[model samples]
Target: MADVLSLKQSILIYLERSGGLERLAEDCEPYNDPQRTEAVYRFNVSVHPSDVMEVDPELGDCLLHDPLTATTLFQSACFQVIKSLSLIGKLQTESQVNVILNYTHLPPFPEYTLDLCRFPRVHRPVRPVSMEGLVIAITRVTKYTQGARFLCTNDDCPSAGGFHHIRVHTPGATESAVVRNDFSCTNCRSPLTEDVKFRVLGGEIISGQQRTSTSESHCFVFLTRTDELCNSMRIGRRYRLLGIPAHVHKWPNIACSVEANRVQPWNKVSASFQRLLRETSSSLWRFSAVVAHCFGLHVAPPGSYNTLKLSLLLSLMQTTTDAEDTFHNVDLLVVTTDTLIVDRFKGSET
Candidate 1:
């Protein structure tokens, strides 16, 4: 009698099962649960009569079918999951619901709604600013433009839009003239002009000249280390970069307590000078070793092939020898927050 009663109850369940009675459920974490290390991403799924074929053999045999009822049942199950989690203080926001729906990889049905309170806000990372190389050249005044001349920096003005202009006063000279031209853009050669004009940009001199202008337009564009910012610019000179309102000047041989020490040779025995030279030598050796190692590593793999080669090269160069530090030539690599300009004399044997 008990077996007969169980069979009757099973028969009633078979008629109510969706499709063929295969049950499926989605397992997603609720938002702001704080129980998980990371937020849960979501997805979507679709159900149909064809999708049901497991769990109940009787339902399969009977072929129960009802699309509308099946959809309602599926929606109820999903919402129940969400509501249960919400009541448990797990469902964080409406956005999380949307995430789960979309993550199932199915188009959202009209019955679905999203929760937004569950997710944390995202922020972007910040970056540091940097400058590029420059080369300044002082060209002779054009014949057509009397009392005017061009101080051409190594940078092509047309290529880099407008060039850097600096104003300077000669000790015994009067006012001069200047002129400029726009060149091609550095990247796209679309007849480029300055996207944004830099009015007060300044730099030290690497090379320059002192000459008379034939034209009225005397222009100085400090684009390179070898540029003359003054009317009487010269080679083997240094300058201070300053910009005050509309006036910009590249003052030459402007001494500061910081860099003034490097200008003179140490004829007297000073500990500071001795230490500076020693530090400079050691730095040069390290730079050379680093460069050589980098080059060797590029040729082959480090452990089996390039390793032996790099080791051999280092031995041959005597990079480990403290005595060999004297042979190394180390130029100063000056860096600043705003620029990476290197000051090297043009045609100098040193």
Candidate 2:
């Protein structure tokens, strides 16, 4: 005779060989429309070839794979949590429960097709519908875009093989926009190409649609200081940014000015700024600092935010003034109705 198992043991045994139960358990919940859920689940199950086919002759055949299996795991986890809540008498009236997902694999386009439903519950449904009285459904139908491709190209290098970032938006939205990096190869001195093939945790590339090609024609003028350390009084200390077309709009809130018909001022100002901020840091910091500056200008993607902030703050320490006056001694104060006062006073007494 086979040994009889308790509910917890049975749940554990069922999920032992599958994906880690703790992680999947965080996704479980009550299925209002089991029929629709099962319908979609079955389709998902059949499509995934990775699911187990024939289990041991003693145990029954498994039901799901890939996405279906993922959903089942979510359900299992939900059940355990809900049951625990009920045991403690903390499970209040029905509410559409959702787990906060910090999905690292979220695609650029939106996912999850929504459907309206009416159910009686204290909390709103995950996907809500416009129905009068009784239950309100505010169900959040989350869809996963696991196979979306992520391509990264150096923002400064257009000739380098880019566009690996191209991803197809599902359910007919806009074509995928390019999200490239400002990274360059220190060894080859070429733009480092980061494609979807390189994943964060697991190296996996997914299928994505392709878009047509066109040269950006945008001349990226890098305004970097000369490789020389000099006092603020030195003339060549300022570098110049050249080759940018005249017809460009400089960002409104930035200190840099933009010329739309000529690239002369653009070049001069860029050079001056670079020369003024020049320092004797290693090449690594120089490269990182430049990328960091792009992030400050909002020219780089969101990923550069933290790096830019940190790098810029550190770069301030390297500022070389003829009077050797560091910014550390300066107290920047802001007064009412737009006035910035940089007060630098020596210690003690009037």
Q: Relative to the true structure, how large is the alpha-carbon lDDT of every model?
A: 0.29, 0.28
Off by over 4 Å in 1: 1-27, 33-43, 46-51, 56-65, 82-350
**Model 1 — which ten-residue stretch has the worst lDDT?**
256-265
Residues 92-146, candidate 1, lDDT per residue (tens digit)?
3332222101011112331121111112111111111111112135445322111
Superposed Cα RMSD, model 1: 33.1
Give one digit per residue, the lDDT tens place, for model 2 in 49-163: 1222222211221221122223344334444655664421222212112221111111122121111121221232221111101111112222322223332244454423332
TM-score of 2: 0.19
TM for every model, in the order presented, reads 0.15, 0.19
Residue 183's lDDT within candidate 2 is 47
Regions of candidate 2 where Cα sits further than 4 Å from its true position: 1-69, 85-102, 106-341, 344-350
